[model samples]
Target: MRHVYGWLLLTPAAILLIAFTHFPTLATVYESLFSKGSTIRPSRFTGFSNYESMMEDPVFWKVLTNNFWFAVGTIPLSVGLAIAMALLVNRTLPGRSLLRLAYFTPTILPMIAVANIWLFFYSPDIGLIDQILGSFGIAGHNWLGDPDTVLPAIILMTVWKEAGFFMIFYLAALQHFPEELEEAATLEGASRWYYFRRVVFPLLMPTTLFVLINAVLNSFKLVDHLFVLTKGGPNNASNLLLYYIYENAFSYFDTNYAATLTVVLLVILAVLALAQFFFLDRRIHYR
Candidate 1:
């Protein structure tokens, strides 16, 4: 009777997982093996044809490279800033609450709205950055218009937007940490930096792992701001894989190719998850 009741309780969630996650993944894989249909032409099986085309597509390669750089640029910087912000705000300094709020406010705002605000900040000569540089006799340069600067500009905004949210996780970990360790370290005349490096950091490894995984996933998944900010402009300089998938599926009406892109994304995420479990989990110290 208990087993029966347990199965009954699990049924709805299992159904939902299968319906939404498993089914869609399988469907995407199925679709990626075929050719796209049109008004006059019908869909047909062309095994691995889409994948071959994806390999041949220069735009796909560009977007994939962009995503790699995007992840590389955003993850470490955002996570480091998050740790710094958490440490700063964790202390009972003057107006600490206000400082915390200020740090966290960007996380709560919609990315579209934030992107719009940043658009002005990146505008050529009229932007806030240019205006500030003008006072120092520094000539203003186009921030987003140039391919060299566009990806970096997007990365900077992403770090600013994501850092605070990661900070909350770090702060929670810090709060739950045992204060006795700090006291002992203080009695031993250990410097703050030494104590943090030796004692505090090891204990926070689990939280760091969690935040790192989240940052990696966000680096790939979060493309809402890109729509408003650049639309992958300046000759696809700022394009991301997810945004490219959107372009193919909706804008170009190429669902099969989009499915192929999605399959690649799924494989990347799966490999990342497996790596975290196998490699990263071993290094994390859990209490």
Candidate 2:
């Protein structure tokens, strides 16, 4: 009866998972296979039509392109900044704790809150960013309103917000590095860069991989702030895949098509996840 009791203990969580998460995803897949609108009662088994239609939809293609750039723009920038911040904060210095807190404060704040603050920063007249640019006799450009600048502006804020959180991951990795290995290199008269490249970096490889995967995932999932700031436009300029999916389901009531878009997103995420795992398996230093 011990085995039976163990299964019973697991039942509640299993039921909740199936009820909430698993069931909804499966339902989306089911819905994507059907005709959502263009019907009286909704749903007809027009297998693969929804997916095929996305290929031809110009708006869908545009949003898909936007999402690709969003991911490309955010992940590397965030990861690079995060690693740099981690290194800086790891040192013993005056005001180190305050610096850490300042960097990390954005990470804990709600994204909507950050969006509101950044909206002010991007304000055309007196906003901090434009105001600073104005000092040099440069015209104060509307950062978020311009198609060329919107994604990059959002990417900059996102990097600042995400970097400090990832820094904590690196800090933990830094703390656990075997002192002996570093000391051996130092005793051998190795330069600072040489020590970092040959000794410290190899040890932190696992943390780097973990943070990269998380940063990549965030690039796709964390587009909520864009809703408040961009609403996916100055002519859909900031339209990401998730925001586009939201537009379809709620704004346009194209539930069937939205379901299909969701499937595409899931496929994209799945591919990234697999790539992350493949790289991690090769890169992580087990010792």
Candidate 3:
């Protein structure tokens, strides 16, 4: 009777997951093997033709390369900043609550709104950055207009937005740390940095891994700010894989190609998940 009730409770969630997530993913894979259809022509199976075309597409390669650099640039810096912020806010200090709120405020705001605000900050001549530079006698340069600077500009905004959210996770991990460990370290005359490096960091490994995975997923999935800020502009300098998929599907009306791109993304994510399971699972220290 208990097993029957358990299966009944699980049925709705299982059905929803299959309908919404599994079905769409399988459909995308199926569609990627075909060619786009029109009124005169219907989609026909081409058997890896779309994948071949994707390999030949220069824009696809450019965007894929950009995504790699984007992940590399943002992940470590944001995670590092998060750790720093978490450490600072975890300590007892004056106006600690206010400081915590200030750090986390960016995380709550919509990315579109935040991107719009950053647009002004990156504007060439009349922007806030330029205005500040004018006072220092340094000539203002175009921040977003230049191909070289646009990716970095977007990366900076992403780090600012992401770090605080990661900080919250780190803070939660810090709170659960046993006070007796700190007391023992103090009795051993260990320096704060030494104690943190040798004792605290190992205990926080699980939270770090969790945050790292979230950061990696966010790198691929969150491209809303790109739409508002750069639109992958300055000759595809900041173009990311997900944004490229959007361009193909909506702007160009090439659903087959978009499906192909999505399949590639899915494969990449699957590989990452496998790696995390095989490698990181062994290292995580659970309480």
Candidate 4:
């Protein structure tokens, strides 16, 4: 009777998971093997043709490279800033609550709003950043227009947006640490840096690991900002893999190819997530 009740309890969640998550994943994989159908031509099994085409597509390669650089640029910087902000706010300081709220303000704003705000900042001459530059008789360059600057501009915005959310996790972790640890370190004449590096950091590894995985996922999944700020534009220079997948699925109406791209993305994320767990799990000191 207990086993029957247990099965009954598990059934709803299992059904939901299968219906929404597992089934879609399997369907995408299955769809990737077929060609896109139209009114004139029907869908047919292509058996990896879409994948082969993806390999040959230059835009795919460009988008993949952009995503790699985007991750490289955003993750470490965001994590570092998050840790710094957490440490600063975690200390007993005047107006720390306000400081924490200010740091976190960007995170709560919609990405579209963030993008529009930065879009104004990136606008030529009349924009805030440009106006500041112009004060020194410097000419304003279009931050989002130039291919060289667009990705970096986006990176900066992303770091600003994401760091505070990560900081919340770090702050929570810091809150749980016993004050005695800091007191003991001080009694031993341990410097702040030394204490943090040796004691506090080691203990925070689990939180760091959690934050890192989420950061990686967010790096790839973030697309709303792109839609508003650049539309992956100025010659697709700022295009990331997810936005490219969206273009293929919606703009080009090539859902089959989109499925292939999604599979690749899924594979990349799975590999990265698994690697992080496998490597970092060993170092995490769980409390």
Candidate 5:
């Protein structure tokens, strides 16, 4: 009777998962295997043509490079800033609450709101960044408008929004670290930097690994700000895989090929995830 009740309790969630997530995933895989023109008609089984086309598509390779660069730009900046912020906030500083709230404000702010605010900062002439540069007798080109500056602009926004969130994770890990370890090091007259590097950092390895995986995933998934700030321009410089997929599916009405591209992105994410589970999971040592 208890087993029956347990099954009944789990049934609704299982049904919902199958109806929405699992079923749609299977459907997409099926659709990706099919061939269809970019028309309003149904698609037919096209077997590997789309995959082969993707291999030859220069734009596909370009966008993949952009996504890779995005991850590279955001991951270290955000995670390192988070660790620095955590180290600051974990201290005995006064007005820490105010500092924390300021750091975390962008995390709760809507992506559109943050992007709009950043856009104003990146604007030429009257924009704050430009105004400051102009005052210094340095010319300021449009931050999001220039091909060379667009990706960096987006990367900067992403780090600001994400660092605070990752900081909280570091704070929790810091709390779990034993005070006795630090005290022992202090008694030995170990330098602050040496003690932290040898003791504290190794203890926080698990948390750092978690943050790295999360930062990579978020870098690929969250590009909404880029949509408003750069729109994958000027000339596909900021066009990451997900945004490009969105443009192909909705803007150009290429649902069939869009599905194929989405599957490719999924494969990339899956590889990242599997790497974490295999490598990071093994590397976390217990004290």
Candidate 6:
């Protein structure tokens, strides 16, 4: 009777998951195996043709590489900044509430709003960045138009927006830490850096693991900023994998190819998630 009741309670959530997540994922997989249908022709089973095409597609490779670099650039910097900010505001400092609020303001803003705000910052000649440079006798350059700078500019904006969010988790974890640990460290005459490195850091490992996973997921999933700022423009220089998938699905009206890209994306995410769990699960010291 207890088991039946438990399942009855779980049924709603299970149904929602299957309907929204599982069904769409399976449908995408099925679609990837077929060809894009039109009035002149119909979708036919093409087996691995789409996959073959994806392998040969230069734009696909370019975007995948961009995604890889984007993840690498954002994840560590954001996580490190989050930890640092959490440590800073966790102290008994003046106007701490205001500081925390300021740090978190970017996180609460809608992504579109954030993008729009940065759009102004990245604008050529008359923009904030260019204006600062202009005052220094430096010529203004198009930050978003240049292929070399576009991805890095987007990465900087992403780190600014994400650090605050990750900081919240770290701050929460810090608050729950036992005061006794700090007392003991003080008694032992351990330096602040040493105490943090040896004691506090190990204790924060679990939080770090969680934050790392989330940061990685966010890096790949974010596209709203790209939509507002670059549109994957200037010769697709700043394009990431998910945006490329969007371009194929909607802009080019190639849903089958989009499905293929989606499947690949799903596989990459799953593998990375599993790898993180497998490796970090061992080191995490759960309280």
Winning candidate number (TM-score): 4
Candidate 4 weakest lDDT stretch, 10 residues: 278-287
What TM-score, over all chains together, does every model reach? 0.93, 0.92, 0.93, 0.93, 0.93, 0.93
RMSD after CA superposition, every candidate: 2.3, 2.4, 2.2, 2.1, 2.5, 2.2
Model 4, TM vs. native: 0.93
Return the lDDT, model 1, position 124.
89
Estimate, for each residue in 1-287, the C-alpha lDDT of model 2 and write its tens digit: 99999989999999999998899888889999988766567567999999888888888888888877877888877777777788788878999999989988888999999999899999787899878888987889888999999989898888878888988888877877667876788799999899878877777787888888778778778887987899998899888888889989999898989999998888888887897777776533344
Model 1, global lDDT: 0.92
Compared with the true structure, what per-residue lDDT tens digits does model 3 show for residues 1-287?
Answer: 99999999999999999999999999999999999999999989999999999999999999999999899999999999999999999989999999999999999999999999999998987999998998999899899889899988999999999999999989988998888989999999999999989988888787888888879989999899888878998799999999999999999999999999999999989977986786575433344
After superposition, the stretches of candidate 6 with alpha carbons farther than 4 Å from their true spots are: 1-11, 276-287
lDDT against true structure, model 4: 0.92
Pairs of colliding residues, candidate 4: none
Off by over 4 Å in 1: 1-4, 279-287
Compared with the true structure, what per-residue lDDT tens digits does model 5 show for residues 1-287? 99999999999999999999889777777777777664585577889888888789888988999988899998898888888888888877999888888888889998888999989999988899999999999997888888888889888888899999999889888877777877899999999999878987888888898888888888788978876888888889999899988998889877777888989877878898897877576433333
Across residues 73-143, which tens digit of lDDT does each residue of candidate 4 receive? 99999999999999999999999999999999998999999999999999988999999999999999999
> Model 3 Cα displacement at 227 (Å)?
1.2
Question: What residue runs in model 4 are displaced by over 4 Å at the alpha carbon?
Answer: 276-287
**What do the candidate models score in CA lDDT, each in turn?**
0.92, 0.84, 0.91, 0.92, 0.85, 0.92
lDDT of 1 by residue, 143-193 (tens): 998999999999999999999999998998899878898899999999999
Each candidate's number of clashing pairs is 0, 0, 0, 0, 1, 0
Better of 2 and 6 by TM-score: 6
